[model samples]
Target: MGFIKKLGYGLLAIVAAVALFVLLCAMNPNLTKGLSEILYGKDGNSGLIGSNTSEEVSAGSPGLSTPAEIGLPAADSGIDASSLVPYMPYNGTITTIPENVLGRNGYTPVTGTGEVLSEAQAKETEESIDKGSDGSNLEFDPEIYPYYAMLDSTCQALYKQIYANACDLVSSFAPCKIVNTDQVQYTFEAVFADHPELFYVQTAYTEKYTSDKKVVEIDMAYYTIANDLENARNSFDSAATAIEEGARQFPDDYSKEKYVHDTLIQTVVYDASAPMDQSAYSALVNGRSVCAGYARAYQYVMQKLGIPTYYCAGTSGEDHAWNIVKLGDGYYNVDVTWDDTDPSSYDYFNKTDGDYAGTHVRKSLSVYLPACNGTQYRNLESSAPVSDLEDESSSPSQPVSDAEPNHYDPYFDPYINNDPQKPLDYESEHPESSPTATNTSGNSNTTASPSNAAAQLAVYGLKESDAVTTLQDYYNDCKVQLVSCGMGDHCFYNIVPESLFKTIESEYGKQNYLGGYMNSALKTIGASNCNIVIQAERLGGGYYRIWHNVYVW
Candidate 1:
């Protein structure tokens, strides 16, 4: 009986010890986890319920529906990371709409990047934006024409396709959907029909997707371009350096431009079948290329000199290319290729929009670049008429004063004395060209009633403060003459002296206030990049109507 009693007590003691151990582990999970790790190493305990580890918790939580239920985007939902957009810090909270948004620094992008554009005062930007009334078909969009016009036709098509495919790259870093092979192939062909200028893309193909546009597990393939950008960039650098060496032969943009114009005509011949003639490389390197090469080379050199210039392409009867040059007080279309015929002629050089009219048919994709109206540099020391020039005999016998009743500003001296090769006639040497002239300057358009430019910014998703800042900035920078400041469903209409367009660039240099105005407008609207679409109209002698959708891009 004593032996049996001892055995029973021992068994009871063992049971109590076991129960205590179990209670300790239950109270403190760390105890069990530590024990498990000691006994079985890492991965010893599978996900125990209610663990705070996201990796473990993410798999499943007792009654949890999905990641979405936990305020997280669902797994396998394309986006994999926290953010997919480029780093653009939000300026502030969005509140009531602003009065004026664009704080004009005078520099607005023609359409794309690296194109010598107008910088928003704070140095913001405009890229590719479609100002189409009908959003369905982007190709037919008229507002984007100026952007397209700035590039060679092939690049115009390329930029359009890439712009239309903005969704393909931005799934929050998710795997891109496999696109239709046909569409991908078409884009590739269109983009490289003659090799793109800005895209820098090499080989492109569809990755993973099944047939049937619908119900197919997909990845977007359009903007997922494989860039073969290195070699071409190297080539452009070399070309620019080489051109700059030669450009040093002349002083200012005007002189350098004329020298380049004449040199290109003297050096490069117009060839119908020049090899690889669509690039600046062919024109600058090989000294043999077609119109495209000439135009590209011209733009490259001009931009280096701090002069605003563009490679403009269009159908001059058939496929052709040329340049847009800002010289003296105006923008003109210069066809180095056309001017390079036997003996070479200046007839096609420095022509206005009206001058190039009926001759240059702008590509549909080009941005609506302002018309080339100022005839100052027309024909460059030759037969082209300086339309504003009065007959030498009609000049006032003596000098004019600020109080004079002349139709033009007395502050602006017309550079009346003439020297044949000097188009501006030493205007830089005179007092009229002083930066102070900007303050005294007045345009007839300013006499019109001024409207509140801020009211129109609401369409661009701006608060009243931002709107006021933008318009006030632009008004201060551009000194625009208000024709109207009315709002539409998604745009604004305003008027300024057309003369402002021509002089703003020259007066303020590249540091003009319009650049700030544009950047502010972009921030107000929350666009990731800058591409403000503005439509310009010739309001007759030195007046313009600008129809703009300020935040489309």
Candidate 2:
């Protein structure tokens, strides 16, 4: 009887120990995840009900939803679809909306880890928020601040809050108002995109929300600790100031912009593992960074010099970031990271949308950025401008009249400009000696019209109208125009019939047909790659004007 009682007592003790362990796991959320890791391996299926581990708590605990529930936007939401940038997770995967939530209006979920706060926890977190003034005095220019301009008034206010907090390096704060995960995410992104000076803060943030899912607390992450922030800022300012001062010495706007571009390429080396890889500080101070660092560095210096430069994030085979600078009146794309190749290249310097068609595509809120169409300053360093190639006054035979812009004179042979070897004055100096043109005598060396005019005739081949009727003809017309214009860096303009306008535009989206046609022309010039950008506009009478800026290498 004594032995039996002893064994029973031991078993009872064992059972109590098991129950205590279970109770502790239920209370501590992290304990459950730790158990999951032990059972399923460190990287195993930690998710039982939802994807976000922070939201995944034991049964009956008040927890946030996984994949974070985003309600449809209200009818009065006024959220532009373009303004909704995708949330990029720290692991580098893009967080997508659930299939069920597609087409519904709502905010996008910001990518980060945080918990749904209890009422008491919310009160505690709220107290920690610094109500101090730091970035309150900062002003934003709507024209220059593309991301800020995308936000509605409410979100704009949130942007100011996030910006101010980040500038001050406030560890945690309550949002100025009750905002969903979507507004917080977008506003946070806008703040970073618009302001490159917020280098210490990281993109991922932690949010504590009420059980009802209203975000109550935000903890902004930082790359630099508070003690080291001032030193980092001083270093950043020194480097940026030096670059800005150097750029100001240049005589023209293009020269100053180019100087900054060249300086960045020379200073920064592409290092994916560099500390603070996303911040301009990494590129400017450490001399090592990835695409984000390069872009932000360019943006900061240009903005300091009072050049309107915006950071552009997108995908180029992988995630990438670049800049769009307002040189003169038009915006032009400049990828300092890409141009910093071995021996350096101007492949992406001062390019247009058509110039970057397939290679670089803007994603998220960046799509709303102005289309880079400025051609005046493109490739200025690599080659002489067409105006510099020959004397414009030398072309007396084919005089350009301001009133008759499109007036074609077959006898004058305007295509003579296509040949770089032949001087424009050659025709006037030695009229009969010119190979590309004919003298006033009706006897002509060339039987066809000029490049552009002849291509126009081919598109309207035997048709009573001037529009391209089929996709095949449209493709052929573009290639012929490029080839006829000597396959050099030039713009090839074509008009599509109203019926085929949308279809031709669709081909550009497909990306295949344009490449095939551009490549065919490229082969003639003995170049393997080319920068070809096609921009189109709708004309009255069902006609569409399409133009291609083709630069071959």
Candidate 3:
């Protein structure tokens, strides 16, 4: 019995020792690390499980064991780790109102019922309810109201606000469209409401007119659109005759003007042809055109008629060209081009007297006619008598010297001065001898000298060539000077008498030697008559270059 008790005691002591050993192993860092390696199937040398091991082992290495390797629940084996985790709602709260509550509030569901309100409830609503005497709560039936009326008043207000804002933005960016003559005139008329002060009136008999007389005098000078229309009545009659006569009398001049005029007249019908240019005339001998061609043809004809007329270029929707004629004290705007249109419609030939005196007005004379100062001609309206402006003076008014041809008049031809070659007094000098003299500018008594003429021609010819070559050389030299002057890749050459460059460009194509290079070079040297040496250097990784130069005349 004693031995049996001893054995039982020994067994109990062994069990207690095992529990103590398990606790010591759990607490021991090294022992616990080794146990983890055994359980996880990690290599003993790996630092991952065995803390004392120095060998590095990555968590995903083949030698390391994860939960799946130890016969534990695997990721895809119908085992959900999330099922073991705490539950959380995706969204904490609901936001939508209940349908029951909406219905309770007397709001019918759109999909459920076509009825908006109960008949009794609608009847109870007042026809004209005033919230605070400001006429705010005016109720109307939704079904009976217009579709647009059904829109919320707030929405209508917002739409108007947006439209106004958009319009303001557009007007700010493109003021030209808003403040144009058409718009301004319309607005002015609306504000004035036919007020007498707004419109100009002639002086009353009781009042002695000061500026009014000047205005009348100016108006008298102006050739009215009516006058032009009357003149046009005769145009068709004389047109064929004039063309044939012009071709016969002045073939070269006649063909040039005729070609241009005929083309304009033909093209005036098409509105799409508005804002045309001289090229339009050259394009079709008789094709559709606009005001530009009309103005050009008018000027051309007037020039042939010995009238001093200038072509004016200005802004009018597109680039528009008109005419300015030298009248007595100042230049007057005579848009024969505009006048040619119909009085009733926008037809090119029907612009009436009322239209000219009313719509399609012009301002800023300098913008188009550079020669006519804007300040001087701005108020000086067109006043040339229609007949006088169109008429050609007959007879030899003055002897033609070296002076430029007096404004040529198409209506009449002036006599050419006598040729100096056949002297008028030659018959008296040698009564029996036949007169023999040429209209030459050389000394009369001396025999013509070929050497002298040849020498003169040679010098003049060489001077011309030298001028061009000098300009070319200046451009080349200036290119170098531009470098040190802080101007890079930019330089120019300016030659005296600007026309010389034009002559060169005309004779030699603009793309010839020194053309492209000279274009860039010239901008640097500017418009000075001097030889320049320029140097250029690249700037900011772009094609731009800074240039500097010195001028030598």
Candidate 4:
């Protein structure tokens, strides 16, 4: 009897303990996740970690953050969100129509009836199409419309029809030819890539085709229609005009490109749910967009500036968009979208193929675009400008001889071991010489001369005022920190006001600017063959912290 009583109490205690553990698991999600992993291994097979059971992971899961939370921009045009999802169900629809031939009364009717024609009528219509039935009179400059140029004659005719109809807000029309639906899709994409002004249209469309695979009609989708389109265009133009006017203040293409890039980063915010997020209008007017909108806006503005810039679509983890810009004699890739981050980095801006091989791999038609190798203007803003340099727009490949007095190789080749030319003012000798120290590489290394000598210092938890305001001061501070450390390789960190940070970040991207500081420190530590890496982060409340990692051999 005692044994039975003891067993009953033990059972009750076990039940109580199980209930308490369940309660704890329900209360603490991390504990629940740990328990799930223990039960189902780390692939999240228990559905607690990788499942989309919660709204937080609705966009696809395995991570605690959603697509927006992790800063994944919306897929570019032609790339639906399905492309972003892993193992997303694809519902392929096969449009089936009668195999009968399409007979049109007029030269490609503005509207389609999909009427089946008898043999006699079909033969007559084909004859008329072959004759002077005024099919599509389309023309595209290869330089201005590179995508359009890539299409075959049939696709080009369809592209022209789509472009004309979309510009006029003609929603539905018969295609110029009886091509397949896949061809129609390809042609529409070409039109979209060539014409950024047609910002009201979406990347998707509906088509009527026969079972024989002949597309008879197409209906273009639109984000805004009729009057709404005019309003959107006005807003877009206003914003673009403001950007263009601001960019005009800069004299060179590099400066103008940088200005436009910075302006977009400053104004636009990446929003996955932004309306018409694939259109340039969403970015320029609404100030909200994904990678597609950013790319289109950039293409539009750069085209207006008479620069050859094309929208590039590809996969960066998921579907993405960027730009390929013509600078100097060659082309370079610019991804303002990725650079538009919390810290606003130049990590992806104006890079070469070798530079973006890992992060951005072009796909589809974007892969056919020119390779980016514009060494002269890759990071021109970071290099010290030489006076009387020939205009790149007119003389893109003008040779610069090393014999020129003030000329330095605009192209930065890190492989070249440039001997350090110690500044005369390195040891404070000849302190009276112009107050600007000139290195043999022709880069000016000057001390801090902030407009205001008494700016409160903000970096490194320093209370004492350090009048570091200009880029010169920022450069000097980096060198000073490296020399003070007495280490051949060290990470120099500094924080300054947002304005100064912007200036520093721009120059820091320059190989020459970074090399100057590294060389100065190398000279001090008696080392050679150095490398430098820069990292800048935006700390809120109008402050930014920059780190310069210098390594010397």
Candidate 5:
């Protein structure tokens, strides 16, 4: 029994000690209940009463102050409440309302029974009505009303509604808000100062009103007008400069005509095609240009320089374009496209209409320049019908005699005509003879027979003279050939008949002894009516040993 009591007492003492420890832990704020559980061998897995694990604890005492609560700096703390206001769905409501109702009285009753109300209640009701009114009774001040009304209705309504939603209204006052209330007054003042034109009552409004409406309206109008005018002035100045530059670049007055001619030649690169246009002739911009571009650009620049120039488009071959420029007292056909060749050649720039028109048969100026009347120029080619031969006759080698016949020739004389069948009577009568025939009236008596006289005259006519002249001219012209042959020791010969030599000698002077030797040599050869061939040998002594041959005809 003694052993049992001792053991029982010992167990009770242990329990009491545990209870005291728990109470002590509970009484100390720093000693958590979890510490006692761990000491007593409990699982302690519940949150703050958990076993000694590596997990972090975040729960703090209820009375502890957080960093934010203690006024430590925080993000977005200074943001405006109005900015955080939620977007309200669109609803039709006049937002800007006057504090005083337009026609409502403060003494008005709440019902149709007309029960009289206390002044304070009446005033409170009036303020409530004003706050709820759709702002229809609002009156804008005269000074700011015009500028505000000038805004687009949509923008105006939006602005007013935004202001109303953002504004604070007193619940117990007569009028909800005055026209000159702080927000409305500041906005009205700002809008007026910025855009004074809005106050002037313009009918139509622009985007200028929505942004910096005042500044935009004031600056845009004047700036736009001034800018446009400045551009126009600059364009005119540039055109004038181009004209002056052109004149200076090509200082020669005759250059214009030369340009015209050369342009025409190049225009017809070949007979197979028509002339090139402005784009094709751009290569000549520095040197020259086609008639159309030249005339148009020229006229444009000249007009800037106060010179009267016209582009004339008329028909020539197919269709062509040119210009007619006004000089001092006359207007000449200034076909610059035609005159762009070598100036020294008669085909250079400054040719008359007759010179150009004569080259072709159907040389009409109808398609040359379309702008100007053909009658404007004095030398304008008559629009008379010309033959195709005349139109296609631009060949430089072609003769002018084949052109229009003489005005006096009534029968269209066949003798002077280019027609091969209608040969001259004189030419047909002496068919065997050359182109030249001597007049026999003076030398007719010298021969015994008429036939013999005719034969002699025909044989000794201008054709023979021409042949002799041609030979002499060739000799004179080729002095270098003669000298070279003599130095090289080549043979030379004279091959004229003795009779012809005698006639030549009689007409001129007596021949030297060498001439007699030549005659003797010809007799030895038994040849008459021959061509002379001269040969010379190049002997060592700066002299040529001479030889001659007589070739009989």
Candidate 6:
């Protein structure tokens, strides 16, 4: 367990403590017997997690360099020597795909046009998303064209209908005319591929009416896939609930992105050996996964937040996956997989096309996605012009008052030690040594003032970076409570006493209107991120109460 997991001090802190069990179960035939035949078939892991200066990186280095003039023969165009690194799987074995043999695969070029456009310019060129279904540039079987190709509204609609059915997974009962069979099955695969939520399925086979080829029948094997899919659903519920709550306080693309980004890398580990590492099930429930799982998990969480994010695939040494996210004014690349490493980095967080030039390249279905050109979100925290985000001055719960206000600190860190830079109370929660250090990239801020990290760390026993993140959140807005006395599972408990507020709820008879008052108190102390939360509660006659004033880190 890491420092963050012990206190559960994060966006659903890295929840992989029980991963060993997951790995064991995945290898048991009774559990994963036919699962290997899913999407990737059987991946023989011949390599291990790639070594890097960072805590965990399986491919290229963190810094992006200008792509050299190195050009492979036309046949080798898609290969980026960097993609040669070996990756880890759920089984702890390393998988290494030979280099220089990938790219331009087979595919139908997007239509609505003629010429070409580089990925950076994908949006500027409308044709980028319009595919022609040439079939030559395709990767998946032509019958499964929808797997990696774009689809029209009519085709997409048909695809969804079949996907809506709960099938054997491989044999979803699908029927269509012989002439339309390919289109129907391709659409079905597309629907499944697009919905990473279908964590247990990868490939599909149809049982068509031999008497009538026009009518295709699919009887997917559902039993084998149901349990894993069920587990996946449960994970989604927990993750979605937590992320939605966070998004409510900080509504905006940047805030949502950070919240999701912080939550994922904080909880999941980049383990290629992880069974189902290629699926969201591995990351969310199993707790450890490779890049693909991490990317899908990030995509799922961001999508739930009302953000438009696409699962962009490309090669970064081996067959790799990442994301194309829309932020502020434009789209940018975000590789949660690579950033899963240490010293918390923003290198691939929100990057322009130029950043990926030589080291990265998009392939298959991902090629149709919008190009990433925005650079504003590159340094998410520092780049955010707070003036434009939601106002943090007033609490959504508390009303304004004219009388003197009693501003107090909410002390939530149950563990505090004498050491300034150490994590407090960890002796009881996670007593083991060599815990992971993931709270590295604290909120970025530019000011003439130095941070009060040392003091905050001493009082809370959190890492210096953790203090900074809390400070950033606290400084941005005081109305919202950032910390609370939370249990190991992230269940926080802290109440407000009604005597402290003039408006316990708002005029419409709302609740917790004390947000405005809380911000006022934080403003008094030049509030940064605070760890203790004490919120206002509605009492009779428009009175607001709190257990005590929340202590700031």
Least accurate stretch of 10 residues (summed lDDT) in model 5? 104-113
Model 6 score (lDDT): 0.43
Give the deviation of candidate 6 from the true structure as CA RMSD: 25.8
The residue-by-residue lDDT of candidate 2 on 34-79, one tens digit each, is: 7787666454434443334543222222332112221223333334
Residue pairs of candidate 4 with colliding backbone atoms: none
Find the number of clashing residue pairs for candidate 5.
61
Better of 2 and 6 by TM-score: 2
Error of 3 at 93 (Å): 64
Error of 5 at 244 (Å): 1.8
Q: Which residue runs of candidate 5 sit more than 4 Å off their true CA positions?
A: 1-240, 246-289, 342-351, 359-553
Off by over 4 Å in 6: 1-149, 166-170, 177-189, 203-232, 381-553
How much does each candidate deviate from the true structure in C-alpha RMSD? 24.4, 17.7, 33.4, 19.2, 41.1, 25.8
What ranking emerges by lDDT with the best candidate at the front? Answer: 2, 4, 6, 1, 5, 3
Question: Which candidate number maximizes lDDT?
Answer: 2
Point to the candidate with the largest TM-score: 2
Q: Please give the lDDT score at residue 363 for candidate 3.
A: 26
**Candidate 2 error regions (>4 Å):** 1-110, 127-137, 383-553
Task: Give candidate 1 regions above 4 Å deviation.
Answer: 1-236, 383-553
Query: lDDT values of the candidates?
Result: 0.42, 0.63, 0.29, 0.58, 0.30, 0.43
Better of 2 and 3 by lDDT: 2
> How much lDDT does candidate 3 score?
0.29
TM-score of 3: 0.19
lDDT by residue (1-553, candidate 3, tens digit) is 9999999999999999999989999789788766677755455444454444333333344533333222222332222233132111112122243232121111001010012334443333222221122122334232121111212343223223222322222111111111222222222211111111111111111101122111000000111222343443244234434533443332232223323333344334433333222322311223344444445445544443543445443333233445555532344454444433332111212122222222222322122122332221122111111111122232112211222232432222222222111111111123222111221243232232544333333432322222333445545654555432332222333322223333332222121222323334434545212222222221111111212232321
List TM-score per model, in order: 0.34, 0.52, 0.19, 0.50, 0.19, 0.42
Per-residue accuracy of model 6 over 466-493 as CA lDDT, tens digit each? 3212223432333433333211112122
